[model samples]
Target chain A: MFITSAYAAADTAAKLGEEAVKKKNVFPPFDPSTFTSQLLWLAITFGIFYFLMARVVLPRIGNILEVRRDRISQDLEEAQRLKEETDASIAAYEQELAEARKNAHTIAREASETAKLAADKERQKTEAKLANTLAQAEQTVRKVKDAALAQIDTIASDTTQAIISRLIGTKVTKAELAKAISKIAK
Target chain B: MATHPDPIKQFAINKLLPLDINGVDLSFTNSSLFMVATVVLTSAYFLWSTGGRGMVPTRSQSVSEIVYEFVAGMLRDSAGSSGMKFFPFVFSLFMFILIINMFGMFPYFLTVTAHIIITIALAMAVFLTVLVVGFGRHGVGFLKLFVPSGVPMLIMPLVIAIEIISFIARPISHSVRLFANMLAGHITLKVFAGFIVSLSAMGTVGIVGSILPFAMTVGMTALEFLVAFLQAYVFTMLTCMYINDALHPGGH
Candidate 1:
């Protein structure tokens, strides 16, 4: 308003008022009359714009981006948790397998030791039975040999008596034959 | 039709609905219409894009998101994360300017940015915010901004005076740059187009001769499109830098 009044006064005094006002630069931007309205509208427009941006639009966009980031990070954490679980299961399986192998080894060693002890017991029992049989066989052989020697003595005595009787033509006495056989046996 | 189409006439403000209260004219204008249109268009675009609220953005959502990130990144680069508090302000300014600038390139649309008053209004807002924030946070210490470190004390007064003058001139330069560029580009386009119109009004020779100006107009239109985007970018970038200065007055 100040600028416009000053310019208007200057224009009239310069004597080029009519022509200057007609042209007026046609640049309505400099027209002080519109400045207030333009300024008023600008304030209103910018105020509303700021409210929309700060309160609604920017916050919405920022939220969307933030949610996406959190989702990605959550997925990564889940993958890590699954990996740890799998590793634990694998470790447990390996531990079980080792335990099974060690059990089998101990069981095999005990079975082998029991079989050896049984075999040794069986062998000792068989050897004692054989020794008893061998002693009985030796005693029977000695009795048979004594019986044969006694029979041979009897035969010789009988043959001697018969030969004496034929050569001398006399009957041999029983008591005499007995005494002679006795002397010869002695 | 008049013999000459006044290029300046295109910039003329007309009262669509006139209202005066207390000796002040408060009227709806063509400028006001376009500005309101820009606001509606921008608001609708953002709301529509975000309405779906998809995790993976749709086309419009992606576009809106890109614009958001672009301004966000600019703020981050200039003022760090602390300066993101002003994101809404800067973004609104950029979108408002960009849409209006592009609209002006169309056949019948008015460029709001072509006016010095509009730009000055916007620039003044940024300048005032910088001052308020700078002083509010730093107290009297904010004056350190005008006085650079390592300056010799003897010439300090002169340097300080110059710095203060430049600081005051920032909003003027900032606003004028955009206003002048838009105003100049549109004026040039209109002038060249006027040449074609006047030339064609003549005989076959005039029609053939209008080819040069026609080609120039086409080339200038293309250049103006680049300038439209460039001026908006420059304004937003400068605003961010100023905000950064306010937030960190120590020049760090």
Candidate 2:
């Protein structure tokens, strides 16, 4: 009964001071009787709290923070490595492209040079053959003319003999006729 | 007519479980219940918030994280990173006091910090830690904190005496500052509320008059909410400063 009805005694004990120390009030906070329990619970609660903070909760938070930081750094490093690789590959590709273009240009030039040289050689060969064939034809024409001239001389000598015989009833010399025809033909 | 309400009545403690051992009043008081409740609630919040323990934090997790960082930053700024060893003590103190202060604001709930015994116990803990760490780390050189570097030899004794007094008074002031603030703030709020009740009982004009006190009471309650956080912060900050002094004696 005395234990359950403690607050009933609190007010009077608070106002009266030391006279009511035996029937102490808890409101004053300095109540020596209640100090024991308050201090006891405070110690217990704070002890558990300290343990939780020092061991469990704080370390968890720290771990989360540290993990996040490490993950972010790793991501950044991966990104950097990827970027560098991309840049290097691009450079290599560009170099290869330039080399390929150069190679193509040189091949085209060599092909064109070869084609021009071949064309010039073919034209020269054809020109030389045509000149040789034209010279041979000219020589044949000259030979034929000479033979025709000789024949003309012979014909003249015979005509001369016949005319002479018909007009004057006298024949000319064959040698003299032949000589005149040859001079005329020349 | 009902007599004037005792503002102090709200602070009264009752024996919930009558326990005594070796003449000690170990009965479970209301104060013990709230203190236990504070512990339970704080622990539950942390455990529940971080239960998922996901990389991306939830709301309560964020809150807990922010509180941790906030205390860490305070300790780092005031006491340097070396002072981080005391992080648990300061953080627990801050959270315990903060929860108790917030709980006290609830209707019909008692503010535990309003008690000198509790505040003094906390202050003494800080004070004792400072002494132990200071002497342990700095040895006899720790006493140099009481004697400033630049003081003339003539006024050195005076200054030392004053420093010693202040040093001794650290726990007293620290404890009293919080206790008095909560005690007075709550008392003033009760007094204003009392005015409103008494005024409203006197009919129309009195009821109209009662509105002023009613409004003031609302405003004061809001202020008390702010004070609750502010006092907790101040206490934690002071603890950091004291710890800092221990770590670097005579540096200040």
In order, candidate lDDTs are: 0.86, 0.90
Candidate 2 C-alpha error for residue A73, in Å: 3.2
Candidate 2: Cα lDDT at A44:
88
How far is each candidate from the true structure, as Cα RMSD in Å?
8.0, 6.0
Worst 10 residues of 2 chain A by lDDT: A18-27
Over B5-98, each residue of candidate 2 has an lDDT whose tens digit, in order, gives 7777777767899899986878888988999999899988987887777788888889988999999999999999999999999999999999
Q: What lDDT is reached at residue A76 by model 2?
A: 100
In candidate 2, which residue ranges exceed 4 Å CA deviation? Answer: A1-33, A120-186, B20-23, B146-163
What is each candidate's DockQ, to 2 decimals?
Answer: 0.37, 0.46
Q: Which one wins on TM-score?
A: 2
**Highest lDDT among the candidates is held by which one?**
2
lDDT of 1 by residue, B1-252 (tens): 488766776676667887677868667778888888888888888888888878788999889888988999999999999999898889989998999999999976788888888999899999999999999999998998889889999999999999999999999999999999999999899999999999999989999999999999999999999999999999999999999999998884
lDDT of 1 by residue, A48-81 (tens): 7767877888888777767767888998999999
Candidate 1 CAPRI grade:
acceptable
